[model samples]
Target chain A: MLHVTTGAASGPGREPILSLRSAVFGYADRAVVADVTLDVRQGEVVALLGPNGSGKSTLVKGLLGLNSHLGGEVELFGTPMRQFRDFTRLGYVPQRHTLSASVRATVTEIVAIGRLPHQSWWGRPGRTDQRLIDRALDLVGLEDRAREDVSTLSGGQQRRVLIARALAAEPDVLIMDEPTAGVDAASQQVLAEVLARLAAQGTTMLIVTHELEALRDIVSRIVLVGEGHLRFDGTPADFVLAQRRQQDLILAHEHHHHDDDSDVSQAPGVLSTPHGPLEQPAQKRGVES
Target chain B: MNTLTTLTTLGGLPELLDYDFMRRALLAALLVGIAAPMVGVFLVQRRLSLIGDGMGHVALAGVAVGVFTDTAPVLTALVAAVLAAVLIELIRARGRTSGDVALAVMFYGGIALGVVIISKSTSSTPANLTAYLFGAITTTSNGDLWVFAVLAVVVVATTWLLRPRFFAVANDEEYARATGMHVTALNLVLAILTAVTVVVSMRIVGLLLISALMIVPNAAAQLLAGSFRTAIRYAVAIGVISSVGGVTGSFYAETPSGGTIVIVAIGIFLLASIGTSVRARVVSRRHQRAEHHPHEHGLGCGHPAVAHGDHVDYLHDGHRHAPHAGHYDEHDPRVHAQTADESETAAETTAETRSS
Candidate 1:
């Protein structure tokens, strides 16, 4: 058996691609995202979903090893995340809001940052690197725009360039944060196709977003995050089951109240719903707000 | 003109080479030229430029105390400046007040301490100690020159050896910490670098305007260059030009070398800023033309270097809010004008995913 030790951690032949245990995000002393345990297995497509300020972004950053605070342990390839320097191996398509817009780099140039760890600092990319970039661009269907200045591209196209950047690294796992935001329909379709293809090829991916319905086709599992905590984790079918159960409960309660109110209206003294017969959904006609 | 040239800026150069005063001035200025901007890059990026000014003032108090006690001024000043800088860093690390607020506190406190010491002293010459406040390049000594050379070498060596680490610190401190970087050590190093730069530049840019040398050339460089290396190149070039030109101007015009250096630097900055604006306009026009077709992503900068909404710049007013309130991150719908499906796709992604 081949044995190896990776940066302050030990692992067997097969170790987790990524893991987070009791991670917390904070500013100074106050925790913003607290005590989260999560893991992503190879070839799995998991989506982090939440409302505004629900810690999805923090969790993503933490998983990427970009967030500073973690309460317990975070690991990549069984190595302590804080000690890992090979960020390229963990292909991250960062939020569009984070990239510096003033850089005059081309689309190919942006993609090439994905190769930073593989090359020495002083060495410029050569033909082999260019070939990799070209292949990555081809994968994203943006081969024609490889050399074009990235700033001149449409919003949808820019998003493609970022994804292409991530793809260039050929990582076993990909984490895309809000990749579909501000993208066009055609571009979204292309992105979905590419990710679906990547999944078929057996690359693990974790995509975090506020909305998940559009990704239903590609994502195998759903993880709900709120208030810095993971509230749900399972297949999309389980999520659908939960949603349906909630709706059924609401409907049954409403029907029972209506029957009580009708009976009371007719019998004069039958006014009983325990707390007064769920009165007509109690919704004001013109004052719903 | 000859006398002024001889004693004004490079005022002491001949004597410095042949005598002590000129040597101190020459060595000190040379040390300043290299160290200030090199270390200043970290300070400016961290938005702690005023911290340099505060440290310089803190050193001034140390000089005053040295004068009163008849002690070696440079040693006393270094001790005081470094201590004051450490205190400022501690206050800043607490993350309670803005860096400038901490700087202001350290600034007044250092100066007051120095004044009180100076007032009580009888043996020291008030004029000699006072000159260190604004700096007197004319009175630089042989011993000071050697001290400067050693300090300069150390500053350069440390900066070069720690480039990647400092860059990580300056770029994002939080990220630096997460990546297992010794962020605390690096931050301490950065503060020390600022202290060293201030001590050296006091003879050239003056304690009153030392931050200008650190701030102006870099700001001008930022306006002109799109990358970190280019920005530093532009900044150093501006620094060199201002140093050479300011020395010449002060020699002929009979002004203080420190003041003249700052003036020349500001002139260069204004010129670069003007160039940046004109270039921005032209670039925007070209961007509009390219993007007008509606099929391209145009240029990243063609959209203007606006973050959230207002431009990515800070002011001296102490507030960090942007000028564009609601417009920040407000994308123009027509810019990409996507189909309902695409819009719904992301909206669906945001709405439907409750777990991941």
Candidate 2:
């Protein structure tokens, strides 16, 4: 439905919309993620992948100024993070499960919240806002459910409502945290299609996801994090190849130890080395591809 | 029998309105009815239903200050309540202590301070304090009505004008902040608005029972409303009915206004709860009856079958019927018309089913 208004800087050679260099994010004085360097260019769909507590969420929260920006040279739209005032350029869809169950807002009411950045403090929804809200709902295929209470919707439908809410802002980059998490397969496919449509319309996206299989066709790049560190940055094909090679190595190592009685003692070390070597081959495969 | 005789002697609603004091009390109650629940809806949405009670307690201290200083209690209460509101919000924003801890301290401290201050005052008796605590709505002066009117207007206008922003913040503070909303400022404004509501309602509903007026009607509304806006509308309606009815009943029965109003509000809440359960039963019974069918339509049954979510829906007599959990659910075609793409799938499935 072409709901997202394409930004002017949607081509190659455009300055990165979000840039983080030696960034440290945490709560209070403790750094949960440190020394991370990443750049998200215009029109690129980047999937942030990591294990639990890998600090991927912390990094995304840091970008939104939600976490403690302990030490960082983060930039949004070429403006320094601290100096950036144009938040309307970014749309955030938090985890669907995070939506408070107590709220009795309707689908339309929640979607209308996306327009707040563009609205004056005291202004009501104007004609333009309503049209955009409608288009957003249409894009997510939720136009008919606009009047229904959000709590009545299934987990997946609620996620779409959140996506529609984000899309109503017409942001330059849509940042989602585990949009597919806890969502059923059907809803995941629907979300993938919605995201793919947005990507085709030249909208930039930074999605934090563990289910890369669902978004394999849409994600342009993959960023892997482990132990609060950036571990891998490459294309989806490279990630797959690297993952296969790591599995093959583990298999070969297991075969070598099949007859050995002390294999259990060395298993932890062998598994720990896989993450370190994952980066080299993935980067090399990126060049080959 | 005594109560019935008193009611008869007091005459009707028109006779009650004949006295200036009764007129003032009713007008003040009407304003409280409108404003309290309007603010209460947001508080209830945020799950801060007891914050109003805390603000009311703090306002009691303000009334004590007013009495001790020979000033208007409403004005002093407003100042004290607004200050307490701001202080509590700042404490919450600091995140050093949890919100409920702060609320508990404020609630107990406020009433205790008010009682202590009142005990030391030689000019006013404990009876005067009782009037503020339990509410003597029948004794409302013209000056008090004017204050209530102005404060009510402020509460209504601010809430109406800023409803969207308030809802956003209350729903998801982080999302609102990410969207560049001045969340802290909005929260402060809401707290201040809540304080204003407390002061505005305290005269008619009483400081001790003001929270019930703010919360009970909204709670009742939530039982029946399908949306936030509707919940608000319903709550306001319930608030008005309860407050006005309570005031009138109290006038004839010679009972405490605050207790009467709160009881009426609770009564409505109970009725709403019962109504919701009854309606749910009726809807489920209808669904059970509609689920019956003479024939089972499935694959190779000579019916156009469309693949729905987890089951296949067979088109029979122009209605899509899907077997679900041993019952044939009559699927609404209009709900399935979510997108042209889905409808295309349904059409293709129907054609494929017929051909096979």
Candidate 3:
């Protein structure tokens, strides 16, 4: 489990860094993610939670200006994504790094792509590129493997390397889609620390994960998305409270389920006449916070 | 080895450097060397190797028509080839046939039309016929050299200017389109470049081996080079060596000049493939050993309590973490057999239950 420390507000108390207003986007005719409205404020880490086949990836892409919208608007830093690419202000860490293994690229060379927007049309990367790349490497705890081939590293290390690449761009907001998807426990911890540091630096983040239980502690806001709608949106505490209530309801049903199982064990044997009741539930729930 | 020796004997050809024949051959090879691989990088990346093949045949037909007309062959070939390329692009958009299949259809149609034109034309002569199949340096005058060099410069410059769109489409077209890049427009540009490249390189690669030049150089680069930029440079390097060697080697050998260049390029390609095979073997062996041993864990399984990421393990935890821990022994023969036995037993029970 990751320990994400929450601190006092910085800069604006509640200025939206990333916003999507009633946005609708997906394949033609059939919409996968529809009417999705979200506002991620400065210094906030929003954890999006959902079941499989959920619209998490679609919603994120629409907000990042990587996917076309059927309707509605997505604004980054108050300006719409359609106006200009705004490539410098936004950083994207895709769910999968679409790099081929045959090409031998080092961690530094890969990270240098972050400075692509800033460099002149014909200019090569200079000292500033080196400094930013080094900082990003240090941020991800992969500074020791700076010169190492990116493909030679393990899956977790590769994910960290991608994060480093995105961070090297020095964007105000970092959008990561399932950052810890294929990482070991130790690497997940390291990733959490890096994200924590970025959040502290006032970089707004929107993270998508199926691991809702683990995400509950770190997320300032939890949005439950499914079937082209924002099903639930609230603070992490409220989301947890709702989850607890759901657990109680499920537990109550579980008691009845176990009683029926025991009845199967009893079969035609009758001890019911003396007890006066046919069955009794084993667990008492809906009594605690 | 035989080809290199023949090419190196450029000095023994009775003061060949001063001769116009030697200059034309050298110029043709040098110009094609710079241009072929520059267009080749995109062709190989797009997996449209056979598009070059189709365009070459189209150019050959155009050249044949030019020969019979007693008109300018180079200009006629260039315009006709570009038109044929646009037709190939249209065919691809319709998705009726695979690119290779389309190339074969075009290739046969081109040859049949060319043969018919030559048979009927009274203008067909020994000089006209010689330059048609096996390209000759004697036909490549000073005017041809200027056209070749200018075409090469235009191809290289236009390609460099559109590098980002080229790179994006080459990597993934659907993704590129989503980013608002006009992918169809970019694809048309690549096809036009292929057409232009083949026409300019006619004197060097000729009609038969033009595709080989485009594909071979990129294949060499793919073996050892790491990035797209490095691959382009490596491919161009191999292209230059073959062009310089093939054209010069023609001064001595009885073989067709285009054949010699392609063969040299193929030799380089063969060496690169061999290197890649050895590398794959080493990589797979290490991957196998890693799979067989749990002690060789590269990283710890984040969910320690979960033995395997089966349905039950996922059900046990409230959080569904997509883990990075690679399965160690999933492919062991003994384990596989046991699993087969277990599944068979479950199947038998289900059958018995159905009967009941």
Candidate 4:
């Protein structure tokens, strides 16, 4: 479970695991997340924190090629993202089970699927593949329920299975989309502990989450996004300070801003102040969106 | 009437193998039996169950084109079905309409066009057209068996080889693509396979009844199956049993083979549903008993984590625990409606079934 595997080696001249320069992601002809640039060094746990629909998930999907890339260059493991073909080097955990409609695979079968890209079209898993799958289940502490249908698992446990499936690939960088959304507290803590263990073992991670409850202690850096813009890229402590500053700015400019209660209360992080110091947190408002 | 009685008296199991026509019908049934349901299980899982019906109508149009041109019906059906499959995929990828809506439009349009073409064609007789639409299993030729054999081999080999990829794509399309799976190509391949399967299976069950052969057995199997692998196996078993039984039953009853097979499959589905619901009720009762006596473990309970209550210690960091703790039971109605199979399996075995 705590194997010292090679992570994004970040010393002196080591290249970043993922680099996105002015990346623009969207659907059809519109850009949802525009001109975002960031670099993820090896073994560093980065968290993308934002209110709903702030493009944090879209940015991650753009890096993984799941979203439409309107413009910009993305590099993975020092290779161009488009040209990079070694899929086993990277792993991704999607938001939730709602998207997987027809899948009724057993826990073991779902975990075993993590080994698909590593094997040939018709070849069964080798001994090493089996061992990795087993280790992944053990890592998630789900080895006892390997044969149960994935639908049978609780919400939090299902999230763990997804993480286990990603870990089964033994990837260098694990990118997760809202890994703890709707998860119970106990399961979230277990997930936090598991991820912390992975980070300690030199695993690179990029997690997209709106809530910063269980992950507060584990994250090395935080990236704040709002209204399709990269608002702040700094440490967790700095992120808290920036929030306080934004709150103060909204209070000072209350009469001039003339925004609604929710909007004034939940303005975007510091970087988005260019938009008249009143970036409408439309998504966070309970009634507006 | 005497001759009919004679045939019925002689129509035992061995009598099916005696006639060349019956032998050919049985061979075609066996091939269609395994291929259709195997493909259908994936379709059902993907929520594309009606795609089979859509492809069947497209195949009927191909048959009409063949009748008009005096060409091979099966070959023309293959072409039309493949084109229609590609068209459906195109409409689906456009994302303007829901998949079900797109498929419905195509389904009705193809059948309507086929009917117009058949009515306009001079060479097509009413008898022949009726046979094509409803199926004439007694007229199945050796050449038809060869076509079925080739289709069966292609469908089985491709599905088996790409099993993992199919599962991944069906399970989560975005995650599969993120994992570097060529999802577009795989989707096209799956559509093509479905088109071919639908076209070939049409001969045994008729274009009108083809989707039943594809959907009903798998739906029943999903209800009864313990896992994905077992679902496939169970679907195949149900398919084979129902088809062979239907063919045999048809000969004795002097009924249409296609209709008989579909009806028998439905019967099996009803039986499976009844059995599953009964089991669900028993499991739910057992769970209620376990809930009352918290310390006493239920008989045959398999959820080890719930049993040990290990997760109760999980809120160590002052994280708010779920409001519904200590209520995780096999028969919990909320959990039951989500998946009844979990409760059924949990009520029957030790936890070791999965652990080992």
Backbone atom clashes (below 3 Å) for every candidate: 29, 0, 3, 2
Highest-TM-score candidate: 2
Please report the candidate that would top DockQ against the real structure: 2
User: Candidate 3 — which pairs collide?
Assistant: A103-B226, A104-B226, A182-B324
Instruction: Considering only chain B, report the TM-score of model 1.
Output: 0.74
> lDDT tens digits, residues A52-130, model 1?
6777887777766665564778888888876777666777776673333432345666677555445554455678778
DockQ of each: 0.08, 0.43, 0.07, 0.38
Which scores greater on DockQ, model 2 or model 3? Answer: 2
Which stretches of model 4 miss by more than 4 angstroms?
Answer: A1-12, A97-103, A245-272, A275-289, B1-11, B98-102, B288-356
TM-score of predicted structure 3 = 0.73
- Per-model interface RMSD values are 8.5, 7.4, 8.6, 6.0
lDDT of 4 by residue, A76-116 (tens): 88998778888778889889843353645788888888989
In the range B123-192, model 3's lDDT, one tens digit per residue, is: 7775455455556655678888889889988887877776645655665454344334567888888889
Ranking under DockQ, best-scoring first? 2, 4, 1, 3
Per-candidate TM-scores read: 0.69, 0.84, 0.73, 0.83
> Cα RMSD for candidate 2?
6.9
Per-candidate local distance difference test: 0.62, 0.79, 0.65, 0.74
Model 4, span B1-356: residue lDDT tens: 32443355366657668899988888888888888888887788788888878888888889899888889888899999999989888887776848668778788888888888888889877766666666667767788779878988899889888878888888878778988999888888888898988877776788888888888999888889878899999889989877877777777777887888888899889999999999878756554222222221112223222322222111111211111222333223334335544534333221111111
**Cα lDDT tens digits for candidate 2, A1-289:** 2333222334456688998888999999999988888878887788898878888999888888787999979999999999998887889998758466575778899999999888886788999999999999888866646777787666777888898998999988999999999976766777787888888877789999989888888887888887787877767766777667666766676687787434334333222242346545325212332
Give candidates' CA RMSD values in order: 13.6, 6.9, 13.4, 8.1
Model 3, residue A82: what's the lDDT?
A: 75
